[model samples]
Target: MTLLDVTGLTVTGRHLIVDGVDLAVSAGETVGLVGESGSGKSLTARAVAGLLPKGLTATGSVTLSGLELLGARERVLRSVRGARVALLMQDPFAMLNPLCTAGVHIAESLPRSPRPPSPFPPTDPGASPFGTVPADPGASPALPQGSGAAPTRWTRATRRAEVLRRLAEVGIDDPSVADRYPFQLSGGMRQRVALAAALARDPELLIADEPTTALDATTQHEILMLLRNVQRARGMGVLLITHDLRVAFELCDRVAVMYAGRLVESGPGFDMAKVPAHPYTAGLLAALPSATVTLSRLEGIPGGVPAAGDVTGTCAFAARCGQADSECTQERPPLREIAPDRHTACLYEVRPRPRAEPRAVTPREASADETLLRIEGLRKRYGGHVALGGVSLRVGRGESVGVVGESGSGKTTLARCVLGLVTPDEGRIELAGLDLTRRARGGGQAHRLVQCVFQDPTTSLNPSLTVGSTLAEAAAQGTPEGRLSVAELLDLVGLPASYAARRPRALSGGQRQRVAIARALAVRPALLICDEPVASLDVSVQAHVLELLRTIGRELGTSLLFITHDLAVVRQITDRTVVLFRGDVVEEGETARILDAPAHDYTRRLLASVPPTP
Candidate 1:
């Protein structure tokens, strides 16, 4: 029996992180952990790996074949940790040893000892007590086709071969990817390496925490598929913990909704996504740009997470759940099966649930005559290949425009050209009627008319500067003191005057992002070119940021060229949208018209990939 049983798992700490939770995973099963930020998804993963941060304490039984996690010695768990159950953490750049070759990391995760089990338990893939397997194969070995991963095809040469295979599976076209170091590879390549290293061990269960949050759209899709492939081929149990349901919908078979360190509901991923039994889960799904009922319409569970003391009695979510009543605050809901395959944690009735958010809205159309910024015959060939092939497009003044495509599709090349960061080898960028190329050698308003918001907020913000100072840096070519004094700019982004004191490390992902936006606006550029702005944020947070960007464009006379692969986001905020396929503008039109009635086949396929809204 190779099932993992986590019963009455109450993980707590000096800070009261996760309280009560129960979960199980059998060989070939994949359990998704979904939640908002600060919900303790990562914390739970760390506890399982015996790598919990300081000040944390766990009191529960996490057993695999009768071995207790909390009761076992660290050394004993260490032996089985990587060899039996592995961890695929978020941010591979920091997880992978920077100095070592990617190959070495894969090799190092291999089993330390090959000795057979001294006293193996009555071995059976079926008839597991944790409900991972059935007693009879004739009765169906397990769930359906995606019930769980099938048995693995692993061998001695599996590490190297699997590494290459997983890389290819994750969409690494170049075979040399296996030989590159973590630093030498692009973000997507590095992520593939991390996946390879995690799967190289051929463990029974794999824990992945927000694996695709850092990747671009095409890369994110590729990575998601790679995980599914690994699960299918190995039939290994997978615990995918993440804040994004869109991710879970793509690969997970089932999902667990967590909040303030508690598992409130769990069931089939598609079912939960389609008909969330819990209000918190429903709100999460509602906040997705794709799930918003209509443009500029959204519903987020109000109030940030309550502190430990503020959530003592009854349901932790009652404070934020709109359906909460006195009974909700007075009694804690139990995890009970509400239907054939669904479980929810709510005492109050969730009568016939509302319709899920729509997957893709009709995109609005872009005006052909109202071209605010136009790129004509853009060409930036790096020695041999063309990065952008005479790319041309237009953005209406004070309008939001979305540009999406695969990696190296000239998305960044085009964005950089617009920002004047990358000088095009050939082309003319006409912004506000002034040609960018004509003024390359002299100071002019055209040069200062556009700004960029990068993908990685960490690298984009200075480590030493406070959020206030970071935002202040955007002032147009003036000394720190001469610019929009830190205070004014901080307030511009809805940040408090006090935020001027907190450094980047002291802030959250959403806050840091606001700081980045604040910095860009400091220059008072006529055009704001944002590149994958909300890719790393949670759904609720993404809704807020995208709305904020759209709001800023409307309130301030700032025209925006918003770039992202999330079609849902484009549908919500953009007045006009452009679909880029392999460095080519395949579709361009009004947001509502294009989003609702996508004409291009690639755009339609992209729309179809999004999860159905409830």
Candidate 2:
């Protein structure tokens, strides 16, 4: 039975965003909507629930369990929202109330008793097609049994017990977690609490949008597994939205590809992974870094997703597709059945091309004489916590080294110490044989020798300053002989020289990151520290940025101290790997050796947490 049916769904604000999209989710099935940012995946899901933003309007049919939802009254929509459907957003912390306890959040969604009857009738006597609340246990022992009045099913005791039960269902076994506030929980714990709240109402359909995007590898894997288990146990339908093809293939039974606000392809997940029928699908898979293999370059799709209403009478992906020709630009191709249980929107046949064979490239070796930055017995302490404990590392001229660890593992602390953002309690940091530790404390000239690219470009790059102004400011502190002009720096990062006039807000996430890289290079530092720079970017955009960094290292002889939790990226771009666990260096070796046969238990656990390559 179809749980959700959306046909001819069109969302419009000032212009069309989602155009004529058709989607469906059947009972007990998991469907994935995979696409890049601004591809309308979230908007489509929102449209299905009549939850479009203030200015936007949705038209056409959106039915849930045979009831039309589009243009429905607010009261009608409210009645079905939590009882029939639930939405899980990307940021659990933002979704949760800081003032509310975990138990309070879940209890709010439970059905209240002694209330007016529902306007909508139940589908059946014992159950409802949407969702049926479980039979409540009898009233607490304190209630009088001899009273003539009926015992209330939704008593305070029952609600508290239900909250605990919901939390346990999502893998939160500890009962004390219910009393904790959102800030007291870790990222994984917060997400689990959010999931428990979503399931509190016993909705038949769940829409999860990028739920694990911000989590670490192990936490992400755990959340995915938990979602799968809960879905199976309840036999509920799911519509999961994400940019990761690997995740989609791992958890979804059927996958749909969306681009430029339209559905480009739909098919079985495993079949699409093995033999993609659409160019966009193939490009996404090609852009993913392999957890087990290293490649010189990832084939990232060129150009970005077209803005809504930008493409007319032509294929939306023609500008970026390698195989597009004049015919592809002449008319928009309609999605049509291409094979058994497969559909594609491409005008031409998509043949399965063999992937590039893995080639072994020798890892770069750093000689003692060529060492650019050296740290000896670095230690940092904050109150009762130790951020870094005697962590020592070296970066040679033109060498790229990866620091891999989960959150709270001292990776960022180490980077901050080197960048002079945080003064270490004890250590000797040397750059070009100069005493960096003293320079950092005294505000000396060590800034000229090193630069950094942070994880979030939006926060790092000043929104008020244009790209040109930001670059020019950095160039002022650089060596006069090697300083790059604004236009030159923009060109080096593959952005147009004209982009120098634009501010960070006007550019896309990828474009803003490119500008950030350009600003970092404007100073022409000998060593660069990147702390999870591509963690929030789309896979294709991440590939482009990683390749750009590699090019800079090879051509400019700039040393790179890359820090991230993603081991796959480390394997693709770094020469050596350092594994940090709880402020301690657990392992250090060649990238290939560490990834292939990790010596430390923590390193092995990190590798095991990575999603399998599709």
Candidate 3:
């Protein structure tokens, strides 16, 4: 039986968006909706769920289990939403209620059942209602108790039992974790909690939107495996909406490639690698680092996705496609059946281009004795948890070093320590032969010696300020001798001088990241510390950013401390690799050696987590 059937689905407000989209998901099937940002993948999902943003109207058929859902009333849709279909949003943190405990999040979604009273009801006035006494004098109570509290519909004991069961299903084995808040858990754990909450609804069809975007490589692998297991056990249909092709290729049974709000091509997941039928699909595959045998310039599709109402009669992707001709631009191509299970919308059948042979990056010759930055015996503790324990590394002048680790592996903490944002419990940091052990906390010359580029450029770049103002301010703060002009800084990052007048909102994600890089370079610091800088960017954009970092290290002779969970990216960009497992340096060596033949088991696991090309 068809779990979901969306035909001629169009979302329109003042402009025509998500035009003529057709998709389906059958029982026990996982269908992937893959595309670049602003490609209407999420919009299609929202159209089916009746969750389109304000002013946007969804037209055509969106039926689930033989029932039409597109034009259903809010009350009618509400009944089907949690019971028949559940949505797992992109950001787990945004989905969670900061005020609620982990248990309540799952418990509230469960079906009605006869429940028992609290197992350990509070008898003492000063004790926690959940049966724990406060250890600190001024500690806030875990569960606040009151004299005449209004009764809830569900029993505490039953809710707690259901919560524990749901948590276990998502791999959180500890029942004690029920009392913890979302903020207390790591990124992976929080995502698991969100999954548990979604599973609580016991829906036949589930929609997961960019579920692993914020997670580490290992954690992402775990989550994908968990999703597969969940689907197998429950025989549930999944409609996965994401930009990450690897995640979709790994989990989904069928893949649909969307561009400019239209389904361009679709086929069985495995066939996507061996036989892609659209130029856009082939381009997306080639853009992946895994697709190449060696580091080469990623042939990113030129030009951005056209805005709604931007393109008229022509094929939406013709503007960016290299094979486009006058016919392609004059007539829109219908989604035509190419094979028994494959379909594509194009003027010509495209195939995956042959990758170039492996070519190793020649090691740059630099002075081995010239150390730009050095760390000795670094130790950092957060109360009882040791974030970093006895870590040591060094970056020579003009060298790029990669710090590889999963979440909670002390990568961010180490970056903070080096940047003087956090004082390490014990460590000696030497920059340019100057020991910044004690004076780092004061934010003097030590702070100016190193500059950082953060992960989310949306958060890092000032939304209110124009690109020109942001770079100009950074340049103003630089040393008089080293200061750069706004135009020069933009040129250094390969951004046009015209972008100076525009704000971050006007730029694409890749452009925003470039502006961030430009701002970082304005100060002309000796050392650059990038913390997951390309984590949120598209694969093509990520390739460009990595190239920019490499160019900076070579042309500018600046030392780079690149921190990321992406081992493939590390291999391409950095000369040396430092593997961190639970705050300890498990392995340190040349990038190629560590990746190709890892000495530590943890390092091997991290590398293995990287999804294979196919």
Candidate 4:
């Protein structure tokens, strides 16, 4: 039986965004919706849940267990919102109330029912031996035989027990966790709490959007396992919306690919991974970072995803497709089954992988004897907690080093200490053989020696300044000929000259990240520090960014200090890898050797936790 179904669904705002979409999820099954950012994956999910933002209208038939929900009244929605259907949003912090306790949130979603009577009667402590009368007559309460009226309301004790049980179901066993706020919990624990709340109502269907995107590799694997177990136990339908093809194949039973608000392909997860039916899907698979060997080059789909409601006539992905023809532009192809259980929307034959020329060996193997960055005995303490405990590392000229660990693993603290953003308690930081750790704070040579690109470009870039001005300020050495020009920097990062006039808000997340990189390069620093630079980007965009960074390191001959929690990313970019655990370096060696034959137990666990490539 279909647990949730959508037919002829279209969402429109300033223009037609999602058009004529059809999909279904049956009981005891898992379906994954995969697409790049702005490809209408989340928008389709919002339409199904009847939670579209203002100005967006959904027109479609959304049926849950044969009940129509499109134009249902608020009262009708109230009956199905939590009890029959539940949604777990992408951002747990955004979905949670910072002011409320975890227990309160879980308790509120529990099903309401009349309380059962206590098993034992209220008796005096002194007269409980043989059913004798109590000395104090008021101590006992009279009760009728057999079946008396049940209590009309639930008590506080009953609610607390139920909340703790729900928390335990998601593996959050700490009793005090129920009393803590969202800010007090880690990202994984917060996600677990969100899952507990979703399970509290015992819904038949669960919609999880980017459930593990913000988590580390180990946390991500654990969450996937949890979801798999929960789905199997309850036989509930799940629609996992995500951008990770590896995750889609790992956790979902069936997978569907979407582009520009349309379903382009659908099939069994394992089969689709081995043999994709659409060019877009094939491109995504090729872009995944391989663990077998270090990838010198990663193929990326050309051009960006089209704007919502801007696609007109023919195939939406034809503009960037290598096999596109005049016939493809003239007619729109209908989705049809190519195999027993696989369906594709394209007219061309599906290829397992794109043909590529032999990858030329990148010349980043040799490092100069000159050291660009040196750190010794780096230590930082925040009150009683040690952020970085006697850590030491070095980066040579034209070499890239990777610092990888989970959250709260001192990766960011090390980056800050290098950039002079945070003062270290005891350490020696040297750039070009000059110690700058104990120097006074100012925009001196220290800032010019090292520049940083943070994880989030949206918050890092100044919204008030134009792209041109931002670069100009960084390259403040007079005329365009004497110093690096804004236009030149923009072109280097793959952006056009005209983008100089646009502000940060006018650009997409990928474009903004490129601009941030360009800004960091305007000064031509000796070493660049990138802190989870591509962690938030889509797979395709991340490939492009990584390629660009590699190009910068090769052409500019600048050293790089990369910090991230993803081992795949580290393998692709870094020459040496340092594994950190709770502010201490557990293992450090050549990137490939450390990953393949880890010496430390923590390093082995880290590699084991990575999502397997299909």
Best model per TM-score: 2
Provide the lDDT at 542 for model 2.
92
TM-score of each: 0.81, 0.92, 0.91, 0.91
Error of 1 at 255 (Å): 1.4
Model 4 stretches astray by more than 4 angstroms: 114-152, 355-369, 439-442, 477-482
Model 3 misplacement above 4 A: 114-155, 291-293, 354-357, 362-368, 440-444
lDDT of 3 at 391: 96
**lDDT, each prediction:** 0.71, 0.85, 0.81, 0.83
- Let me know the TM-score candidate 4 reaches against the reference structure: 0.91
lDDT of 4 by residue, 1-614 (tens): 88899998899899888878888999889999999988888888887777889999989899999989888887988888888788998779997899998998898887785333323223342322223223322121221224655335557765676677667667776779999999989888899899989977778899999999988888888778778766765678999999999899988989999998888899999999988889999988888876556775877788888864666577888898878788887866788899887999899896567533323333244444577788899999999989999999888889899999888889999998888778999989888877878757435666767889899999999999999999898888333453788899999999999999999999988899999999898878889999999988898889889989989988998799999989988888888888989898999878888887999998888888888887
55-111 per-residue lDDT for model 1 (tens digits): 777877788766777767978988778777888777899889988887677657645
Q: Candidate 1: deviation at residue 548, Å?
A: 1.9
- C-alpha lDDT (0 to 100) for residue 62 of candidate 3: 94
Candidate 1 lDDT at 225 equals 63
Weakest ten-residue segment in model 4 by summed lDDT: 136-145
Flag the better candidate by lDDT, 1 or 4. Answer: 4
For candidate 1, what is the lDDT? 0.71
